[model samples]
Target: MIPAAVDAARAALADPAAVAARWRADHDGPVIAHLPYDVPAELILAAGALPVAVFPPGAEQAQAHLQGWICSPARRFLAAARQGELAWADGLVIPQICDTMRGLKGLWQFLQEPAFLESYNLPRISRASARPYFASELSRLRDRIQGFTGRTADDGRLRAAIALCNAVRERTALLFQRRVLGQISNLDYYTLVRASYVLPPEEMLALLGGMDVEDAAVSKPPAVPVVVSGQLMEPLAVAGLLDQCGLSVVGDDLVDGERAWRTVAEGGDPLAALAERTLNAPPCAVKNGPVTRETYLAALVAERGAQGVIFLHFRNCEMENLGYPGTRDHLERLGIPTLYLETQWGTAAAGAVVTRLEAFREMLEGC
Candidate 1:
């Protein structure tokens, strides 16, 4: 029997809009959708609303609205919005972390015209100086969210939201640890992770907190251990492919996976704490932080005793492309076998990806 938590997570991800509609009915508050690579969910929660991450499948029709060079996720998000797939959402937060994302804000504003539209400006460089600025930006976001919801995200509410989010992160980290230890399957682990993006944080906390990973009926994790570094993984099949090829993801720097759950805000001031959390997060490709991706991956691999490294990236994601060469070179120097695969989100290219992964796994076994 499927565990209730896993089943609910799968159902939620399968139909995010439906889930959002339910949240709207339950909370009587706005449902705000945000693009990935970091938008503060706590602020939205503090405003008495749900924060949903946009990760739509397939962008075939979205091509008409976007240039050919735009990344698949951007195209998919636009397509989803165009198709009324996101009609349940009352607001949209577009984080301007890169050129493509910056362009998306204008398209969304002109086309969709959500009730609440926010263009969040994320600092590319993570530094001490950036924290205060980011905290101010977060404050602005809180004000905007309050304006949309007619509910003030006051200091008390913000602190409560932070505590809830921190609990979710802690629970997620435990699931990840179990997956690395082969106590849970990849499907179970990732479903919960992705589902957290769509489900209300309070709901997610209940679901994850109630999960009994020890007693859940789950498939064995793959035997070959590896670490995956990338912007994100989508369409679910990419993670499934790792399991299919007998490859276990012992560690990752993927935005949607490990990176999402790795940190907790620390401080009495909620916005400043959130800023500190972002600045201190594991290195991200879009953020030119003090720590390099290569160094982070190396440390993760060593800490987890990974057998190999897989650099999976979304095709046409320029920010991820910029850091791949340096990270790959650094790992190669350390004698870490690395496989880099770039695929468009929701494309029928898993066959090609799996073939390459199989060869990489075989090479590792031979050694």
Candidate 2:
């Protein structure tokens, strides 16, 4: 039986708009929409606003404002704002993850001009200076959120929010461990992780912790074990395709996957903790960190016992493109077969992707 918490999470991902609608019916304040990767959601919660994730799914509407080429996610999110899909969002926070996201922040402000908007600039490196810079950014963000919400986030409230978020992170990490042991299906695992983006940390923690955690080998041994890397699991269609194609995702480097949940905050200032956890989590395409991405990917591959790596990057994503050649070369030099899939938000070529994934599975099996 599916856990109730999982059910709630699934409901959130199924229709984030509906979740916001429900929050409106229940709560007394506006919702602060948070984009993916890194936005300190605790501050939003402390501001008396419901912090929700905004993942635009396509570029159809966004293309009108953008020229050249734009990544599917960045374009889609802007499209959501332009199309009134995110009209319920009282404010929006855009974290600086890459050039595409930076452009998105500008376009969102210039074109759509939401009532509340803040571009959170993030540091690309995890140097000693990054911590203070990030913490100050968080402080500034907190002030912006306060201005939007008209509520003060005292230290007590901020700490409370931090504790709640940390609990959710810890629970997600445990669920990830269970998934690594084959207790969870790649699709189920992906669904669970996607749920976290939309649901509040309190509810996510409940859902993640309430799982039965059976010994069901969703992906049996001898199935092709592979690690999937991407900006975010934009369309979970890939996980379903991988499952159908006989590929089991032993690990992932996606923003919503291992990157979001693997790290937890410890003692000290809440802002410092948030900054540290953000920097210490899995290596993102934009953030190289102290340890090289190749080293990080190698460790993940070894730890997960993966036979191959599948990099499913979205179309026109600059940061992912920057790191792709290096990742592919590193993995290939080590004799690990790597498949790079360039995807769009829509399913125009989904059948072709499935066929290619099936062939890749055959190759992994042969190896």
Best by TM-score: 1
Clashing residue pairs for model 2: none
Model 2, 234-282: lDDT tens digits are: 6777777887787888888887788767554645677777788777766
**Any idea what lDDT model 1 has?**
0.82
Off by over 4 Å in 1: 212-222
Instruction: Kindly list the per-residue Cα lDDT of model 1 for residues 327-361, writing each as its tens digit.
Output: 89999899999998887777748778889989999
lDDT of each: 0.82, 0.78
After superposing all C-alphas onto the true structure, candidate 1 shows an RMSD in angstroms of 1.8
Note the clash tally of each candidate. Answer: 0, 0
TM per model?
A: 0.95, 0.93
